[model samples]
Target chain A: MQFTSEQRLDDGVLEREFTLDGIPGVLWTPGSGSAPAPLILIGLPPLGLRKVYARVAARARYYAAEHGFAAATIELPGSGERPRWEAAEQARADLRRVMAAGEPVTDEIVDALVLPLVERAVPECQAALDALLSLPGIGGPVGYEGGVISIGVRLAAVEPRIAAAGLFAGSFVPAAIVEEARRVTVPLQVLLQWDDEANDRQAALNLFDAFGSAEKTLHANMGGHTGVPRFELEAGARFFARHLR
Target chain B: MQFTSEQRLDDGVLEREFTLDGIPGVLWTPGSGSAPAPLILIGLPPLGLRKVYARVAARARYYAAEHGFAAATIELPGSGERPRWEAAEQARADLRRVMAAGEPVTDEIVDALVLPLVERAVPECQAALDALLSLPGIGGPVGYEGGVISIGVRLAAVEPRIAAAGLFAGSFVPAAIVEEARRVTVPLQVLLQWDDEANDRQAALNLFDAFGSAEKTLHANMGGHTGVPRFELEAGARFFARHLR
Candidate 1:
């Protein structure tokens, strides 16, 4: 891991930009000279780091400032400045075409779009975890926070370092990913927007049910997509505190 | 309202047993003397107060000692040493018979069992609220927590003092009560036990969907009806603190 730039926020959080195996990412650590703060690995949607940076940074800062945790996120493959894959682009085009035609999005289209992404993203996240946990002041057990539900499911299922997960509920999950969800035994907190037009609520609920975790909670709130209430951020922090601390 | 007995808990919560217009109830207030603390009117299941007193009083003491909120609950009509009505008894018998025979519980049976209870309970609860709030140290914007969800829906719908509610999701809600739920505009937090064998999960979800409150949240946890995690008690306290304080 090679750090490209560094800056300190007013709240005493140290923000560092880094690249591991040519994949760009950012890490935030608490400032209190606490020997090693527990880490939270945030997951971003396919939206690039630059587009989601401000929002994700605010959450990272909250964790650092108020909750005393280190937080980090890496760009998903084929997003941000990373080169796009041909098959992924084709899948996106198909998805767009189906939605534009006002036809039902078939399972094939969803699988084509999400499965490959989850396949590539999960390994990259694990690699990033390896790099982050190796840092001097960042420690585990780590937590995984909101992003694409499929990727979060995969990571929580396979990654032993991740003791818990707080997932943002979304649709387009492939059947394979739902099956993978059954392997995730870590405690989970899932946030769902009740009226998210871009998502299917029942599918989200079903995915929540499929998790193998004995301790899982689904917090469904009234709103469209992008309307998760601010209070949930603190709730997520407390949840991680319970497990990670 | 007549005070039957009063005692100070070990945590400095003042617990008082009372009866209003011949109906029995209990109230707990913070001993801090921070005059006029906000209140939470706990709703009890119709199982009678003695049966549920220890559980509910623990919750009340939690509110008073930890959150600086007064809490109260009155026995439901035809329950807890109160006079039993034959109609409600018959409905209960019918309900048990159907469940024993593995027959689906029809809406008629549900309405018969719950509607009259709600009709009698809501008013008695309101009268209890009137007496409790009239006391010097307990104040409003009140919250209603748990118990029979239909009674909560009606109280939150028509009771102006009830600013928010935390409902324990249960079945047996009549369609009329479901419509009444749409009239409840207060912020709500509905707790659901996902694998509760006695309650219909889909019905709970649908009722959560029907609430008119723009600020409703559904917190679905894994477990059976009696298996709500202990952490949720604190979560419910924090929720009421957000709205009531």
Candidate 2:
């Protein structure tokens, strides 16, 4: 399937749109250069619609513009410009339909659906990655970033493409998956919500053990799972720039 | 500051510790070979003496283990096992102190703090970018993955990071300081409760817009800011795997 590209601006930043292998997506090209740059693919929560992800995409574009990099955000196969799922059940049913269509429920489907929907929308997350990789300047290798603020930590384990990742207010996947993900050959940055309710310190400890690497940094910020302290962004941005850049 | 390192295991994985300069920051290691891997730094939200961020750190470790990557989750300066904040107000004060102490707040700080906090936390969100320069295994340039999801499009202009991040739930900080935080160029991610009484999707959009590279991921798991979802662990695991790995 052929995809098209369009240009638009949110808050005075330039953004473009396109489809990837039939998936509707958007590209936020930093008017900088055309070299293959780092790409960040965002995952949506189960109840979240394409609009929410679009905000994230727009944010990515802004970041790219400022950082001299190219950025793109894509909607799921059946999301964004695609059909909508009115409720949890409807979303699940739609997922099932996608699976039934012989779509090869890869990591994207699992992230966008099963994990977040059933577990926390981890499985279906790959949809975003797939879309991001399909872009003109994005298909080489990729960096990974996310946090429990959206899905959780476990889903990150399943993605094999992430060379370096930064997680905020994040948690670990099941022990098995945690162990599996730890086997990935990438640099990782994790951000935790010190007062988070969903996952506690003990759980975070368990996750750390599962990772088993020495090149890791741990930072604590203020806020609950829903209330991370304000200072975290500075630390996170520094960390991302230092590592990912 | 001299940093130290130690190792431990939680759920059947190896975890490491890094002392900020030399304190009690913990790190999780993924992978087995005796090779130097890239480093990743994880950030956690603060709630003082709470184990919230700790759990997130552990999850990062688990992701490292599964992905065979070397990683770490660190505590913020004066957080976790280090000098701790006396209260949220104190924490905020500490932030100001850090800003003041740091090499004068430059355009970066202005981009990270002053702008987003003041202008948008309540309304209108700006677009940002998500770019990955590295990842595990897929060693190459990174690219875009998928479509965008714009939740609370109206709130796209609001800078939820430093201002009224969880404002919808009646969680408000001094609007003035929030405005100050808007200028900071710190990367932030805001998690909004779908069912929170104070949730204003429009405000969230504004928050997104103002926060620079902010991204919002919505979940319909049914709960308040402090409540855990039915599949919290399962979902969290998947989230980490997909994005972090």
Relative to the true structure, candidate 1 reaches a TM of 0.99
Question: Which candidate number would show the highest DockQ if scored against the true structure?
Answer: 1
Question: Which stretches of candidate 1 lie above 4 Å from their native place?
Answer: none
Candidate 1's residue-wise lDDT over A94-113, tens digit each?
99998999999999999999
TM per prediction = 0.99, 0.39
Chain A alone, model 2, TM-score? 0.64
What is candidate 1's CAPRI-style docking category based on DockQ? Answer: high
lDDT of 2 by residue, B17-126 (tens): 43333334444555464543333333333332237655555545655565444444333334455654344335456457766786443444333432233232122112
Lowest lDDT 10-residue stretch of candidate 1 chain B = B27-36
Where does candidate 1 clash, by residue pair? none
Cα error of candidate 1 at position A207, Å: 0.5
